[model samples]
Each structure stands twice: as C-alpha cells, then as structure tokens.
Target: MEIARPQTDARPSPVRGPTPGAVLALLKPITWFPPMWAYVCGAVAAGAPIGERWYLVALGILLAGPLICGTSQAVNDWFDRHVDAINEPDRVIPSGRMPGSWGLYIAIAMSGISAAVALLLGPWVFTAALFGLAFAWAYSAPPFRFKQNGWVGNGLVGFSYETLPWLTAAVAVLGHPPSWTMAGIALLYGLGAHGILTLNDFKSIRGDREMGIRSLPARYGAGMAALIACAVIALAQAGVIVMLHMAGLDGHAILIEALVAAQLLLMVWFLRDPVSRAVLYSAAGVGLYVTGMMVAAFGLRGLAMPV
Candidate 1:
C-alpha cells in the first residue's frame, strides 16, 4: 500500500506574534455556537434558578464555547495545517497569518485556561472538561488522530461538542449529576450531531481523499454518505421523540416530530445533489434539528425540578 502524506507549503520565518484578528480567525468563532447553545440547553434542562448563580452560568458558557471549543479548533488547525494547505490554503495557519508554532502554543494555553475555568465550575464540570479536552487532542493529533476515520472522528466531535458541554453545564449549575432524562436527551442530540459533523466533511472530500483521511464522503462516496448522514440524524431524533412521549412529554414530543417531518422533506431535496446541497441542508435542516434539541431540553426541565 502506498503511504500518503499531507501536502505542505514552504515554511516562512516565524513571526513575532499573530495579530488579534488572526488569532480569532484561527479559533473559528462561528464554530462556538453549537457547544455554547448546548451548554445553555443543559443549564435550562437542569431546572435550577439562574438568578442565584448568573455568574456561574456565564462562566460555564465561556468555558464551553470560547475556551474549550476554541482550543479544539486551534489544535485541529495546528495538526492539520498541511491538510488545510490543500483544502483551504487561505486559512490562518497555512497562510502564515497565525505563523509558525503559534497555533500549537495557543491551543496549549487555552487548554490550561479551560481546565482552570472548569475547576472553578465544579468537580463534574472539570471531569467533563478533561474528557472533552482529551477528545479534542485525539481528534486532530497523531497516534489517535481520530479524524483519519469518519465514524470515530465525527462521533468524538459530536460527543465533545454536544454531550460533554451539556453535562458540564448541568453539573455546574446543579452541583450534581443531571437527571437520567436530561442525560438521555443530551446523548441523543450528541449522536445526531455525528451527522452534522459528517456534513462538514463534505466540503473537504478531495483533500481528505488525497491525504487518505477516510472521511465519510471520501470513503463511501458523497451520495451514500449523504444518505447515511440523513438516516443517522433521523433515527436519533426519532428515538428522542419516542422517549419524550413515553416520559409524558406529549407537547415536546409533538413539536420534535413536526421538526423531524420538516427535516425529512428538506432531506429529499438535499439528496438530489448532496455535494452541492450539503451546506444548504446544514443551515436549514440542521437549524431545525438544534432547535428541537432545545425543545427536548425544556421538556426535561420539568422532570429535573423538585417534585
């Protein structure tokens, strides 16, 4: 078997420091919303009074979104700089906007900061943060660079992005583990987000294949990968609806079912040209999916409250 290597660009002289804008670009601020929203959902699902610990809520959000998630982005960019050279040459690291080893330094610094913030939040939050951090590194770094395989990579990202942050937020507020219902909802959403992560791989199929990354789009071909992504997302949400209905959350179940129905309709259109329509489905269909996550979280709030 021929070994494939990531294509790299000529190294430039290390810059003194990256500009603030470059640093922010490397962190990918737009990517922060999913985990931040998941944290908010978890907090709400915990059913604790926010009035008493507004500061903790804010801190938890910061930890989950900008600190932890941003660190992961930095780590990924650092390790995948060569890959980006092929897929997105203009990205900060490859373009030398972040320059030299600054990306690695930033990832390490943010990892420490995230740990400190998680420590202040609570033991459970700290534990979850540690796990998230571990997966963050494993997803991008070699040896266990999970990103080399689509199923493992996407699953790890989804869990770290959705479930871990949700659990951390719940623990931060409640000072204890979340209820079974809350945990179940978070897990289901996390599983569904695997499809979301796979959708992200669509744009980089060529680079992935060239570099032997084995992403879903690269391995199964775009059409089959699209079908698999849609099926996984639908099945996870279907499980959520059934669980919610059986738990006496009829209103929430009905709302989620409606959302799933709308997503299925969109999926039909998306399947027609999965490669071109992936981003469109991500924006529209995935938007509905996350909204339904919030709905499920709210339903669990009632169960979390003191009876």
Candidate 2:
C-alpha cells in the first residue's frame, strides 16, 4: 500500500521570491552543527575509532542532520509567519524575502535527499532517517504541536536529536546499538538536549509569551527555567559518570567524566544570565564535553591494547 504524502498545494504560499540569504537562514546552522558532531563522537565512543571509516559515518550524519534540521526550521518558519511578523519581522518569510510554500518545497526536497543518503548507509540508517522526518513534521504541525505541551515537546525533540542520532551512529558502525550501555547514554544525552532546548526557550520567552506559545520557560519564567536547566545538566553529567563506572571504563574515562561535570557546573553558572555570550558559552561547553569524552574513550582503548 502506498502511503500518500501531502501534495505541494497543502503547503503554505510564500509572500515573495526567495532570497539567497533567506535560503541560507533555512539551513538553521546552529541546530545542525551539534547533531553532526555528536554523531561523529558517537561513532568514536561506540568503538569505531575516528579517522578511518569515520568520514563515511560523518558524511552520512552530516547530510542527515542538515536535512532534518533544515526541513524542520523551514516548516517552522512557514507555520510561524504570523508570530514572526510580530516578534521577528526580519525573518525570511515575514520580510517577504521568500514564500512559505517554496520553503516547504525546499524542506521536502532536503528531506528526500537526506533519506537517500541514509538509504546508502543501509536499512538501519534508513529507518532512523524515516523517524527523523516523521518527528520533524509532527513537531510543529497541527494537533501534534509537540512544542506547545511544554516538557513533552522538549523530550520529544531532545530524544529525537540525542538518542536517535546516537542509535544511528551505533548502528552505522556496529551494525547494531551497543547492548547494556545504550540506556544510560540515552538518558544522559536526552537530558543534555532537553536542557539545551530549555535554554533556547528561555531566550525566546518574551516572544513566546507574546505569541501565546507555552514554552517551558514562558510558563515558569527565566529564573525557574534557569534552575531547571542547571538541574538537568547536573543530573545528566552524573548519569554519564555512573554509567562509565558501571561499564568498567578506566581512569581515563573517569577523568573525562569529571571534566564534563565541571563543564556543566560552569554552564549552570551562566544559565542565570542567558545572554548571547552565555548561549555561546553553553554551546562551547557541550562541544568540549562531547569531544573530550570521545577522545578519552579512544585514548583508553589505545592503552588497553598491546603497545
């Protein structure tokens, strides 16, 4: 049975011609970067050391993340035109730099290409790519509007970004996910994603409040949101440490865990401010922690073998 996808007419009409810059904005660069990096790190952490076939893994994930993230952002811009006009009038669609319908078409095209790349990776990757598309569409769509439901939306997006990609990387290199270790990693990764998303909501709280979007930060206010972000990061860091110990990872792993924990502590300190500088700091911490952990895992693996 053929599943009928929605036709192009079902998409919104854009107000104007597409500008090169508008198309660039649809890429959603910030959202794309971490997922790709995480996938690379995940392949390393899953016992496939970086620098060999890692490029293929990185290429697959690089294609997948941009397609997924970009498609989601374009769809979001389409649905958010009204709100954008009020809060972000300079945005592509609202500013008349691009049509919403065209953006949707672009999204569909990007996702199609993403799925194609996933297919090249074989069945497991294809399956994950399908899920990524489904979640991206359902997130901001009518009835599902996952983001409107506070933590539910946060969890959904976070899990999709964090755990799903981890699974993809694991499957790509190992032909399956690592048994016994996945659950703890999934939990900690999900928490990290949730915390990051909440920080995003904190930044957009004013606009969200005015637009009547019930984001976690909008509902709880900035201080409480900051507290929640701190708690989530702390818990996730601890969980990673516990999981490493349980997995019998050596002192090198413990060292990496401690560094990540300290990084989180620094991140928590800035959650209260959430200024542009703070957001950059948060991103740097995440990148550093992920990179550090991957390097440490590979380092330990090296030491365990014959010299």
Measured by TM-score, the strongest candidate is 1
> 305, model 2: CA deviation in Å?
8.8
Per-candidate TM-scores read 0.94, 0.83
- State the lDDT of candidate 2 residue by residue for 189-231, as single tens digits: 7667777677677556777888778887788877777777667
* Structure candidate 2, residue pairs in collision: 14-99, 14-100
Whole-structure CA lDDT of model 2: 0.70
Please count the clashing residue pairs in each candidate, in the order shown.
0, 2
**Model 1 C-alpha lDDT per residue in residues 141-170, reported as the tens digit of each score:** 989999999999999999999988888788
